[model samples]
Target: MERESSALLFIREKSVGFTARVALHEYKRQCDGGYPAKLKKVLIVTAPLWFKAPFRILRLFVREKLRERVHTVSAPQLGAHVPRASLPTQLGGQLAPDHAAWLEHCRNCYTNNLQNNKLDGVIDEYVISNYIPPVKTQNGVIEHEVARDMTSDRVARLEQPDAMHISDPPYTCDTGPLRHTHGYNGDMKGGHIHSGDEDEVDLITRGTWSSGEASPGLSDEECAGGGAGESAGALLARLRSLGRRGLVAEYEEIRARPPQGTFHHAKLPSNLSKNRYTDVLCYDHSRVLLSQIDPEDPTTDYINANYVDGYKQKNAFICTQGPLPKTYSDFWRMVWEQGCLAVVMTTRAVERGRVKCGQYWPAAAGARAVHPPFALLTEAVDVEDDYIISHLVLTDLRSEMSRRVWHGQYVRWPDYGVPGGGRAQPVLRFLQLVRRAQRTALADLGDAWAGHSRGPPIVVHCSAGIGRTGTFITLDVCTSRLSAEGVADVRGTVERVRAQRAHSIQMPDQYVFCHLALLEYAVMHGYLESADLNGFDDDNEDESE
Candidate 1:
């Protein structure tokens, strides 16, 4: 046996038991006779912290060359050694694992070997020598094309001519100018423009709004002029003029013209308890309908969530209330059904002596939480000063199919208002982190969403799902629009969002914060000069208090 080809071996920590350890030690003893020439590296992933010392001790017993080849790494660190695009989701990679197709490939290889009279009652080596991994299709179906080299008694790699054919172009973070429209399409039906009627007055105060007095920022004169073709500098100047009071007035003007979309499902008596807030409802036109868990009860289909459009991507987010204790299962169901790879949580479980959001996920890493049909395992957690990043694997109990999900919780936002004092730097930094994680998750999806630059909708929620949720989404949309188009249209973006998600950017303070956030982002990214924002620090100081 030449054994000249190199190989990489991946082992999951959970799979290594006492018996496996004994077997591994036996193999190590055998390696003393002569180490295998095939394996170039061995990676043990998801290793517990306690295992580190043992692994070091074990390495000391191995041959010097072999010790250097063996390694242990966390899931996030694995991408540095291997390309994430080629790895499976289970390993924190883009590819979805297909064990059934792999087994089928092994079966074909075994059958071929037996027919060729090469089995000799030992099919392991023969199968290994001839197995071909299945190719994943755009729809995530596994298809195999096996070609055998009879003369060499080995499997031949098949070339896929169309492997590089991506239905949608890969998204790039370009700051120049957009070649197309960058916000919501505003095509949702069943919505009527508000006529400032008495019936609509109560709708303006649906979700929790800040009670703090408005902080001054932009001057009234500076806030007076704004239109579609305004340059980035002009937009920043206008944002600077729109002091807290001006922004509040602008928000009230927007609220007066509310696009009141009906929420029949949300208001249904059976579904009323599912909603976190009585008045904050998902619109009929864009609600995320769940497949009924009970075929006899149609009420099981309702969850208080709507699909909000993103810049150039329709249904880019599932904006919903934070899961109530009773609706945790429904929440995970929505996650599983929609193929959401990330969850952006902007509020804590409890705020200001009240429960703001439910503690739906496991409390600590290496713990499990069962939500009926689905089980979520918190694989790892990385806590930062401003946010906490959770790596979770959600497994379907019935089907045994699992998907990795990233849960990012922004913990620094005030209970009463938005983040970043006045500049919105903290919130913007958190947004950057979320976007990077989302982009990586989208890429890992491996073309499941063939034609969309933004993949499956990211689940965003707060207590009421409108105030903080809307502010976060609005910041994302406006900044993305600014990045792609070289212009920021805060009013237009909020209007488009409200058209889908009614009452988005609930408070005038949040509306003002969006303008400040966009202005800060523009100046930071060189879209506008910092000099354009002079004297804004005084306003930010006032807002901070």
Candidate 2:
């Protein structure tokens, strides 16, 4: 069977050498051999020069497609490096993230030969001269905006069987004398071509991989007044010629590696009203956390949301769940078993065997709460059943917690060992806790919780109950049908958890933060790396290794 293809996308790579090499490899392969058949005008699709890796790859992948006239599409249009800044008008060109980076890259690189319709043997002949989608510029400010003439000229470069569509360069500029301006903003007021408002633009000067190096083969005649120090235009032209070569040529160094998986991409459900307050929508994680505890059914059955929105009743006794148990679980279990069940509220893991059942405890990363901890479990001790309780002794507990947090010592974390963004300490810690909790749940229930118990042992894990508990649900979702975007139907996780119990991880960012934290830790430790993906290949033929 064919293996699953990679959906891994490159946000960008920091390697200049890699990008340039790849671009050149693609370009040379493209031009080196082929039928003597005619190849029409081509559109170059690239990541905003600032977005180096993905753009380079995107550019290479689309070369053949762009060579097909009329329907050509440029690199920036593909959404690989989306412009965060909005365009000024219908015709304005999109903003690049960083101009300086782009310039620096251009300085040391050679653009593709077909750029900007440069028929001559010049490197930057393809760099678009006209800016598009205008912006307002001032005398002293550097701005990013695509020019109208540039866009029209780009369209004009396209050809059809009957007629050629083209635009004449703005004849108003000082073309006769070949004179240039120094750092004049692209505004029309004082010979500057304006794109639009500054507030609307994001700075691309910093994002572009740029340098001051001139194109390798410019003649002294061509290099003269070449903006070494004279004018931005001269400098821009010089660098652009280089940009055409490749990102490696454009960017001096690209720190190549992997993607940061700390972020979770869950679009808010469309069911939400635009004016909704707090407006946070959780997946199965949140729902499961909220419904795991039933104050009424002390013997069994964690309370679930009675309705679609939520349930209103309370006072149910239920076994609670928590983020796959760790420092927090140990703390709760020790305290609960101490015969403090009445005086101190205690929430215990559900069914005892599942690792994620501990997410019920509502606690943050810090010192113990002044209010005595509580543990509530759904497993009812029948009149005949035996019970093994837990207790906590504070013997220098505060000091240990302190050492763990501030001193960066080996301290226990839930599902994860520590909270910081490095190492797999957290995951290892979590795995340990979950395995323990699951074992305990199963032994106590005699295999009842996975669905044999006459009444499901009320797994009650608590506090506000939301984020932590939701982690389990998220995991379940992840293990389900995976998408190319690295997303899962976590809402389903929450819904399933809600069916099991009430009042799961109640705090926001807890569920999201927990998973992200674990992932961050995994990523930093080299445990997780974006796999080489084949998703970007729009071509029909398989690429050779």
Candidate 3:
């Protein structure tokens, strides 16, 4: 081998599968045992996000002098390191090598050398028989020069005899049943409330109260008459009657009740720094505990998140605080351990010049951000009018396995109040997009997800993980109920969520916004006529100050 030669490696995305990752890891181990003094420099281009972290970890095991020679760069940045004249046209260079001619010359030289030495007995017959010269096509293209499409037989022969055996089961990339017992205080209904049948009662009847009649609030008389039934129109009429004052009063009533469960884990001095707010704590009974990275250290399993039930499914959502700088690793660990498939972010990273949440993900497509053992790669991003959807792949460096996660961030929602200046259309539309994505991902899981009524818990977070987070969860649950049973229980849904996550619906306005969001959903889905909301004022002008 030439001592002063440099190597340039181009990695295509399709070639970086699980088997390739394992093989690369074994190669790294050999290199670390004995650093290659012959190679001067190695430049790797278009490497997958999963390969970057393990490479960095490999540097720690290699000699310091050899570490500085290896470099990883994007295609556009290659010019800064290497001259364009020495590169191939495919890699933004001026020269392209004639691979066919090079192979033919090599074969001729080998034949002459063999004839002069008479070394037929010294060389292996299998190696000599397999050496075939490159062939040219009708269009003058080298047919087998690159070996891009190698046959399985050739690959099997090339594989090392003592390859590492993987003992852990292969990751199906599908969510299984819940591993831990959920702490939901509500009744266990055993299955999903919505059957997804088109013939189900998705639309609400006009009921006894017409659009022209005065709104009948949820008074003692109405509760006894038709309010007790699961009628969507009756619920809407009661919600309209509440108006601003009644809604605020209803929120106050929920606050007055003493919170259930204790906060022993959250109050510990070691875990205090993990929480965004000192008072907004997760209930110990329902808190989601991380699988301890260090078995000896108990604090390694702490994260400010909880498992909250949705409609009829247990542990349907994992509500958590926005990840802090130190807790990014823990956030992803919880995501991986819990088998979560979706993440819904309701607040921006920065609001009013303050950092409300840390930027835990990559900033753009084809970029990656590492949080120690977990590396997140943004495969693609779709920007919409009110939100952004990211297609992400999360890789575990230790296991060399990966899973896909769908991330939806609603940017228009302000830190203090709802989006669209208290309007509900934007929020409802965003919810629709999220649900559609979730359904598609679940279906991709096939039989693993098909065995259960609901997929794994969807991770949700905002600034405090209560205000906007709670509101979004409430909206999801209430909308599903209304669609299945034609009834929206705004107050009951908020109470149920707060039972698991303390201080959920942080502000009274958020509590009222849930009702407004549900009403809009009812009208938009044809459950109620547009004229039904004629006398109702959906604005939050009188929201609590």
Off by over 4 Å in 3: 1-230, 531-545
Return whichever of 1 and 3 wins on lDDT: 1
Candidate 3, residues 211-300, lDDT tens digits: the string is 101011111112111112345677677876777667888899888876665565676677889998887877655667564456355456
Residue 25 displacement in candidate 1 (angstroms): 56
Q: Give a tens-digit lDDT track for model 2, residues 1-545.
A: 00101111122212323454454444444444322222222223322445444543554455443322211123222221111122212212233345574464444233322354543654422222322222321111234332233344443543323221111111111221101111111223322233321322222221110000001111112211101121222322333343322222222221121111100111222212211122222221111111112234211111121111111111111222232332343333322221112211122233235333333322333223322233332222111111122222222232332100000111222332223453334434443343344344445543112211111112223222333333433332332212112333333333334322333333333333333433443344444463121332222134343
The global C-alpha lDDT for each of the candidates, from Candidate 1 onward, is 0.62, 0.26, 0.61
Candidate 3's TM-score reads 0.57
TM-score, prediction 2: 0.21
Better of 2 and 3 by TM-score: 3
| TM, every model | 0.58, 0.21, 0.57
**Candidate 1 similarity to native, TM-score:** 0.58
Root-mean-square deviation of each candidate, in angstroms?
18.1, 27.5, 25.1
What's the candidate order when arranged by decreasing lDDT?
1, 3, 2
**What CA RMSD would candidate 1 show?**
18.1
Clashes of 2: 139
How close to the true structure is residue 118 of candidate 1, measured as C-alpha lDDT?
A: 77
Candidate 3, poorest ten consecutive residues by summed lDDT: 206-215
- What is the C-alpha lDDT profile of model 1 across 37-111, one tens digit per residue? 344345566666566556666667767656654566555444433433335656644456677876776677777
